[model samples]
Target chain A: QKEVEQDPGPLSVPEGAIVSLNCTYSNSAFQYFMWYRQYSRKGPELLMYTYSSGNKEDGRFTAQVDKSSKYISLFIRDSQPSDSATYLCAMSRGDSNYQLIWGAGTKLIIKP
Target chain B: DTAVSQTPKYLVTQMGNDKSIKCEQNLGHDTMYWYKQDSKKFLKIMFSYNNKELIINETVPNRFSPKSPDKAHLNLHINSLELGDSAVYFCASSWGQGGADTQYFGPGTRLTVL
Candidate 1:
């Protein structure tokens, strides 16, 4: 089984709508969680980052991680067409290796 | 300016052929990584280098080799490429291999093998 699992969503939402993207992991050793946005034919861009089991907010985006549940989420407020992109959740355990395990990206489309 | 860059943004080759994708990062980062995004959009780490030294090498096949000429460059070479090698390869770099500090990714190279 993949360490991280995420729905490969083609979720479409109208502009200004709130969007929630999530991922689940089997490894409780994961301590750092991150959300990345990737546009068509482009590399993944870092969107939100959180450490362990708490919520971190930056502007209209919020990242929440529940270590006990091994679940993480990325929330986008006032979503725009420009925000349309694949959202990928990634995690890693610190101190030993720096390699991050990734999930299959969820494709998101924002309607204008 | 492109902080991290990869050559041959689109690579098309046939099976049994040998090819290499070159990557360079201008962010002055000590650590660099190579990741593969399969058709299912599953991104997996292939290799990583820190300051011209080999660090993290995943469970990749021996046919897939990564070379780092310096701290700023990490290149991937595939010998006897197979059809399963068709995927987008991305190069990324981080300021340090620590903390929640994010790694910056380069525009990926899409490889299509016949």
Candidate 2:
């Protein structure tokens, strides 16, 4: 099994709807969970990250991690058309620091 | 200023050819990484450098090589590029160390090997 597993979703949602993107990992050693947003022709940019199992919120985005279940999620509330992009989930065993394991990414489309 | 920058934003060349993609970070970061995103949108780590020293080298082909001349720069050189090498290559840097350190990524180099 892949270290990180994320559904490569082209999930379409209407503007203002809540969007939830999720990832599951087989490695319990992953301590850092990150969500990245990537637009067309652009590189993935880190949106938010959390080192613990609780949820971290920033404006319209929230990142949740369940270390016991090895699951992570990114929630976008009041989603806008500008939220249309690929969302990538990444994790690292803090020990290596830069050795990040990234998922296949989920493509989200927020329609007007 | 752009935190991370990569040269030749778009690279297109024939198979078996040689090419290089350069990356530079103005964030004064000590760690840098090279990641490849394929057409399927799967991002995989190729190599990483910490202060101009090799740190993480993934299970990539030998034709691909990474060089870090300094802490602020990491260049990816493909000796004999194959069609499979066509993908979007991204350069990223972190402030200090560990995944907790937010990584800033470059705009990405889209390489198309025909």
Candidate 3:
């Protein structure tokens, strides 16, 4: 099994709808969780970041992490057509190497 | 002012040819990284440098080599590239090597190996 698993979803949602993207990992040592948004033909950009098991909110975006279940989620409230992109989840153990294990991004389309 | 930038935005090269991708960050960051995103959008770290020193090196083939001339520059050179080397390469920089440090990524270099 991959260290981090995420559904490569072309999840289509109507504008103004709420969108939830999730990722599951088998590693228990992950302490830092992050969500990145990538547009077509562009590099990934950091969206939300959270440490350990808790929720962090930034405007319309909320990031939640549950260490016990090895699960992480990113929720988008009142999504817009401009939010259409690939959402990628990444985690790290906070070790010296500080290498991030990334999930296969989920493609989200917020239709107008 | 771009925080992170890469040269040769699009590169198309024949198999067995050598090429290089250059990365520079004006953010004065202490850490830089090289990542490869395959056609499936699976991003993987290939190498990392901290203070111009090699810190994280993944199990990439020897054909790939990363050089750090200074804290602001990290370059990747591939020798005798293969067809499998076609992918999007990204350069990222952060203030430090900590896991929580926010990384700024470049626009990425799309390489096509024929």
The local distance difference test score of each candidate is 0.90, 0.91, 0.94
User: What's the TM-score of every candidate structure?
Assistant: 0.95, 0.96, 0.97
Ranking by DockQ: 3, 2, 1
What DockQ would you assign to candidate 2? 0.71
Judge candidate 2 at residue B39 and give its lDDT.
93
Candidate 3 lDDT over residue span B1-114, tens digit each: 999999999999999999999999999899999999999999999999999999989999999999999999999999999999999999999987865688899999999999
Q: Judged by DockQ relative to the true structure, which candidate is superior, 1 or 3?
A: 3
Instruction: Return the top candidate by DockQ.
Output: 3
Name the TM-score of candidate 3. 0.97
- What tens-digit string does per-residue lDDT give for candidate 3 at A1-112? 9999999988999999999999999999899999999999998999998988999999999999989999999999999999999999999888876788899999999999
Q: Which ten residues in a row have the lowest lDDT in candidate 1 chain B?
A: B94-103
Q: Per-residue error at A102 for model 2, in Å?
A: 0.9
Ranking of candidates on lDDT, top first: 3, 2, 1
Better of 1 and 2 by TM-score: 2
Better of 1 and 3 by lDDT: 3
For candidate 1, give the DockQ.
0.62
Give the lDDT of residue B15 in candidate 2. 91
- Model 3 chain B scores worst on lDDT over the 10 consecutive residues at B94-103
Rank list by TM-score:
3, 2, 1
lDDT of 1 by residue, A6-111 (tens): 9998899999999999999998888889999999999998988888899999999999998888899999999999999999998888654567878898999999
Chain A TM-scores in order: 0.96, 0.97, 0.98
